[model samples]
Target chain A: MKRILAADIGGTTCKLGVFTPDLELLDKWEIPTDTTDEGSRILEDIHQSFKSKGDDHELNLAGVIGIGLGVPGPVDFNNGILNGAINLNWMEQKPIVSEFESISGIRTIVDNDANVAALGEQFKGAGSGHKDVVMVTLGTGVGGGVVSNSMLIHGHGGAAGEIGHLYVDYNRRFQCNCGKKGCLETVASATGMKNLAVHYYESGMTDTLLKNGIEAGTLSAKSIVEAGEKDDALALKVIDEVAHYIAVALSSLSAVTNPKYFILGGGVSRAGRMLTDRIEAYYRPITFPPAYENTEIVMAELGNDAGIYGAARLVKQFLA
Target chain B: MKRILAADIGGTTCKLGVFTPDLELLDKWEIPTDTTDEGSRILEDIHQSFKSKGDDHELNLAGVIGIGLGVPGPVDFNNGILNGAINLNWMEQKPIVSEFESISGIRTIVDNDANVAALGEQFKGAGSGHKDVVMVTLGTGVGGGVVSNSMLIHGHGGAAGEIGHLYVDYNRRFQCNCGKKGCLETVASATGMKNLAVHYYESGMTDTLLKNGIEAGTLSAKSIVEAGEKDDALALKVIDEVAHYIAVALSSLSAVTNPKYFILGGGVSRAGRMLTDRIEAYYRPITFPPAYENTEIVMAELGNDAGIYGAARLVKQFLA
Candidate 1:
């Protein structure tokens, strides 16, 4: 009758889940993430909310086995510390594990948000049944999580799965936030897609809805993708270009880890087949032959719930 | 005391070693690889050599716990099968582990040569004391092995760590044996270096000892790297270009699985500090910042013996 608690902390919101030891979500909710005082109050806020939730559910807090946190930053998993979360305004190392454990009196595990999402997908979503998975999350920016042999590959400095920063566009046409030109993020992230659309439109290939979106100051990755789905020329071109860059990154990733499944997640991934089809087409001819023959491109199935599921699963895995 | 047997099976020679369970090498030797008849006799030949070595050294073959084989191809590790090895004319699936086990009456474990070599380096060479390591072997061709969290990452199809095939040189200038254009192997291998020398020379940059070597058919990756050490113009340029591509590949690798150390081995690595220093210089400016700061590029310490050491380590790890 043991229970588990999980949290996926992001820039704006924190998703919380209460689950049975078997990982069945009993209840889930969200709360605003307060960035005041550099997120110093975040852990206390989370603890209060969990306490209230347990009370409301008539749940015994003592039955909770542990809590897992998916934070928006690199994590020193061994120490359960957030390296730095710029998005959360926690720009210095935060001892999340010890603080959370002390407040909740429960064991805690912490990992990068993207990595946990990948674990979630691998455990019960797109990557279900696959031991090796690469999940690329295309939200405001691009992020990735690599699972090899069913374990997250936290690189030397917890920078293992930064797929977005993979150098892809050798022409260096676009600059990434990471101070690198030609990164996959420069062309495939949501903003990167918008930028590509603008680049294409300004380069005299302007016969599309993106032009309207641009002049109206309504240009966004979603609109561009919708236009592309509707066969808008410039938007489709941008999709093609984005898919190409994504495929390039996947090809390189294949050569490196050769995961069985490359799961596309986040808002942009809702493009689904429209994006996966293009990626597979471009990926087939370019990726390492063995990887091409063995690996599959899939869509994320858990949607927004992936983070919470991943977080809970992290606790389950750690306990196991 | 329990003992272990290890073999590194290559195209020309098979290096064999005997080690105590403590991994202390008791003896080592080599024999010509009988690659005749599609390599059908390979297991018997290895067994014969091991038996002879045991007799000569008064070794108790009965005390050997297991034998580990490092083969020159993709492996189905779970099945203990060589998927295929073209260099040894092993073009079809071969159940190496079972066959060797049957021949030698010793349990067997098998892995790709590059993978075991990486494990070797990680266990006791340049990667000693590091849990995550990436080893790049710049031999006649470029090969790589990636170890993460103290385990080799053998992707879905055992095609993980195929770093030589990483897509580089967006220009698609050179063709790789894998039928790809602009792979890391197309520019960073020993032959790749020679080809770069040829490309540079043909493009009218011919003002070095490389020209004389080229004219004399003595142009080698070694000669070019050595000449680069003495500041030969064309040779230095080729070295710079090779180092650039290697750095680019490393940067991408760092973004993927930022290992603690990049162990450079094989003949091309014999260029020593001249090659590593340039690689580091170029690598520092391009790699993911965390990786650049945390990962160190070092020369392989085990050299030709790495394969045998790695092979033995494989048995050790498998038994553990």
Candidate 2:
């Protein structure tokens, strides 16, 4: 059995796991990440942790296949290099797979976490047997991964699934962090939700936020969504507006990509089908007719571990 | 050398070409179509033409590798059935390839003309040798084709690459025949351009069309664009509005597909670089950075002949 050491490297924490070929999770661990400067130190910590585990089980001495990693932000999957991951504040021409292989004495494969997670969802999660699937991870920013004909759709420069940056309106103007205006991210992402709330507060729809001093500083998107769940009048108003834009994005995506399965993931997707239901409610009636009946929308099933599982799958595909 | 008979069925005319394995244009013929009854008679006409040609050549004609057809509508490429073609009035299902083969005694493959044209552009036209490409055809209604990783991306049931029907605004309540509102097709196609001009005229735009009595429904999209080229005020306003929506569709498609080549085709694309340049001007600013820098947007080279070229290529691939 080929064993893979899969790791998902986020900004604040790094999660790792040892898994068999069949995705049998044998062992798991996590460590606080020092992502700001000297990121290679994290590699040393992982090696030390492996050595400690090796002394206990002699698993490495027995032999293992390889390692896999899923990094945040844009990645050059074909090259296994750190292309440009904003969440990790990493800007490296570093050969990630080569570095990891040098440290662990095993082959390694790496890809963007969103793409890895999408593969995991397709292989063992909500996507199941579906071949064409699009997974949208809603976090601070919107992250997307597209799988078509049983292959991940990472286009030239690994920009294929960057649906977050798509613009809903070309005639109007609004600022986006990717140095664009009127991007779907400007209205449909977590930051976009906050932006909408700010707009609402400005428009005097703040009976709830005014009562709770959320006025002076930026509020977490989670807090705002939670408030809406509790029927906060202002939060509900902002969410409705955001939901419509989300529907527009989804409808547009469906028209272009036409994936059979549209899976929603990450912390924000835990808002469950409520947001998705609203999104579909608005999406179905507005898009071309066939899409309304055919496409399936569901919340992700694998949760946080999807990245690790997908990373392992990449390791198997690349290393084998 | 494997030879394939490639056919492109348009609204007003049908074009036929016999191509060699190397995509050499061996022979060509054209015939005006009679679409009084859902286009079944057109297929019979094509089959009879092939039979007469075969008899004249004194050939046994059993091993005609494959026949590839390019239909003028949103076709379910996987199923080889068509839907949503307004001019043809084909509301019901028709087995285009099978019916043709049954009559002509040739194995056949069929896809929407736009999808085939994308293949033509990618394999033999402007986007030749590009692994990632998206092609748009701007005729009666807008149509699109997607090629990724050197493979045509036809989703389950062949519902992929239907970009024209995408909605940019959920709140937009404009009437589309598909019962949708504010679809990209509503503003991005030749018909859409004419519609925008009418909207402009109705909303009291400066008069130039009134001088030609175009308000009486005599103005074609081509006529309006011609007027715009002469610096006519109302035509430029309507064309610019149409260009903005085309940019919206392009930005959204680019974000998800991240194609290396974006090629524009169809009858309206004859407006040439005028429409393409304007689209790029609008999309360049709004596009997500890094992507905009990498992706190339250009006019399609194949034009009306793209479908036949694409048909030959697709059929050749199947034989290969």
Query: Which lDDT tens digits does candidate 2 get at residues B141-251?
Result: 778889887678887557678878877534463566667778877777877777777777777784774346464667788888788899889888877777777877778
How much TM-score does chain B earn in each model? 0.94, 0.87
The Cα RMSD of model 2 versus the native structure comes to 3.3
lDDT tens readout by residue for model 2, A1-320 = 44677888888888888887677788888877776575757766766676677644446724667778888867777788877666566665667878877877878888888998998898778888878888888877788788887778887767888878877644344577887777777777777777777777777776785335466675877887788889888777767766777777778777777778888886666776557778878878777766546788888998888888888877777775
TM-score, one value per model: 0.94, 0.90
What docking grade does candidate 2 earn? medium
**Where does candidate 1 stray beyond 4 Å?**
A55-59, A206-208, A215-217, B55-62, B206-208, B212-218, B226-232
Task: List DockQ for all candidates.
Answer: 0.74, 0.64
Worst 10 residues of 2 chain A by lDDT: A54-63
Worst lDDT 10-window in candidate 2 chain B? B54-63
Give the best candidate by DockQ: 1
